[model samples]
Target: MSNTQKINSTITHASINKCAIPYIRYKLVKKPPEKYIKSLQLDLFSQFVTNDKSEVSNTVEIWESIPKYFLTPAQVKKLRTDTGHADPYEWNYSEKGGNFTVRIQPALIKQGNNKYQAFFPGITEELVEEALKKILTIQNHGIHDVNKVETWVRFSLRMVLKELASRGRDRNINQIKHAIEVMSSCVITLSKEKKEIWKGSILQDLVTVGREEYLADTDAQHIGRLPLFISHAINQLEYRQFNYDRLMSCDEQLTRLIYKKLINRYRHANLINNYHFMYSDLKSTGLLQQNREIDNRKKVLSALNELKEKNIIANYETDERKESRAITDVKYIIYPSNEFISEQKAANKRNSDSDKHSIDPNLISVNKS
Candidate 1:
């Protein structure tokens, strides 16, 4: 069978009876109930920053200490041995950003007395990952507290900042604030089959500014709440856990984002050692700015090389089609890493324990037949 046929056949034969484990339980915090959790009636605008000197210092300290515990071999082993009960639901639902495209060009947008700037961020990967995590966090909460269709959630600003790798630098908080503002203001035009399906922004409102005196440098520590529209999209998100440890090993920002994007696109499928993507699509989604195609191609090649060197991925080949003495199309063939396999093994073991001999829902299982 051809590659396309094989992919289609695999997808058709796939029967997922449970959702993939969300996060490594060993890696997550086991915190108690919060007065300000996901709530519809919660005043997100009231979630503000503080003006205390110690708050800023503490935030900085947390940010600095956060990366010390990325995905580790022990953590992977722990997740593999974990036998938590996962909901028996396939993660085949459509992802929000799957078919959409964002032109990371910087531009200013106006919204009723607020002028927001939308730009391609330097920390694009971090923001994207945090956004996905937030979606999961809120949706998981919605499953219990409220309906998951479009529920508003109140999340602590410090929590999100830490997840976003906030270094408590003077500029880190502002950077995150601007990132959210850009997401809220940027225009998203969704299309299918070369036709426009919907046009709107990803975020409905800005972070609620609270009146807390957390730090001297920062005046108001803002708590975040998702608007219904954004939550609606997130509610429909179906995703797999990528190798966070291997991903964090890469020091480059652009490389990390591209790698995550690749995983997000292909993780739903049962890809063993190989995956491919069109050059144009990679350039459109992976590259930061809408720059020259050749330059973008170079950057993509460089990033992929870096990943290969770091052993995140291996054995990658690119197909460059030259027409009229110009490169027209490119196809990338890359293999999964050893770390990726370890993660799949963990998922498979968990599935066996939870659903009693069911197939892995993440579609990342090894074909051990």
Candidate 2:
């Protein structure tokens, strides 16, 4: 069959039973509550519908259903001492929104008898995670074991390096390896109303094979496991999809973060309307870290200009509030580019197509064959 025909067939079959395991479970439930049944049906349908990575495209899937506070901002950086060695101290990042506070602590790793080091999740870690997600989507059909809390993913070190290269960044195997280690070691803790909802490392159970020379070779394969928290998050239906190529084309980390944040904010809004954000609010998200207001404004302007050059934003205007001739605050009004609007519309159509083809749960039956 042609690739298009094959994809259509897969989608049709998936829509019929929504995968065998979930359908079987649904049948086993006798008189399940309405809420429970709805959740189950949604979960079952989501397994096949939400992830459209199989369709030929340059876009990559990113999990956006999880609370944004759980993510460490681009501004977070690794600490270094005067001697140029990593600072062996623990630091905490906490953000309060409404009644909940999200906190992240980079767990200290023992280096020797008396030395310890802490690593924060930054751009490199983010790149590694994105590459992994892309690999999973391409090879595993973006399927994760719902029965297991942690899912094992096998990938070549060189594969990750190549993925990074495609995303407009080139790095050696050691750099990728170190980023994976940091992701595995860093601890993210979330609490709502003083009750801890979840806490875990971004990745865990990492294993690398091959001798030193072989491992250094570009073709060597390695494996890493996603933690329970991440695994559960992947099973959720809601997510954000973006053009991987466009995102990686960004030369600066700040610009990339700003683009992602704006895309998420603009998902449901009309493209004709202007969107605005306070400079202080952007700072709260960890995008701007300059100590002075003027410096921060410059950083924002530079990033916005880059976004405009990339055609992600059509244009942006900055409004400054002054008190006694001193700038008190700044607001940025962003105009979405046609390219970005088209991408959003395409994503919406894909989602709508998935929903349109969805079959009722009562009509689905297990295919024992």
Give the best candidate by lDDT.
2
Q: What is the C-alpha RMSD of each candidate to the true structure, in Å?
A: 16.5, 11.2
- Each candidate: what lDDT? 0.39, 0.54
Write down the TM-score of every candidate: 0.52, 0.69
* Tens-digit lDDT string for candidate 2 (1-369): 000000111112122222111111111111112221112322332333224433212222222222232234323343544432343232222222323344555645555466766556677777777677667555432334433323455677788898888767887887787777777666555444454444555665555555575545756655566544344433333244566677778887678777777766677545668888777666655545567777878888998999999998899898998899998788899999987887777666655654433444432321212
Local error of candidate 2 at residue 363 (angstroms):
12
Candidate 1: where is the Cα deviation over 4 Å?
Answer: 1-148, 151-153, 166-171, 193-196, 205-207, 210-237, 248-254, 265-273, 286-292, 347-369
| Best by the TM-score measure | 2
Model 2: clashing residue pairs? none
lDDT of 1: 0.39
User: What TM-score does structure 2 among the candidates reach?
Assistant: 0.69
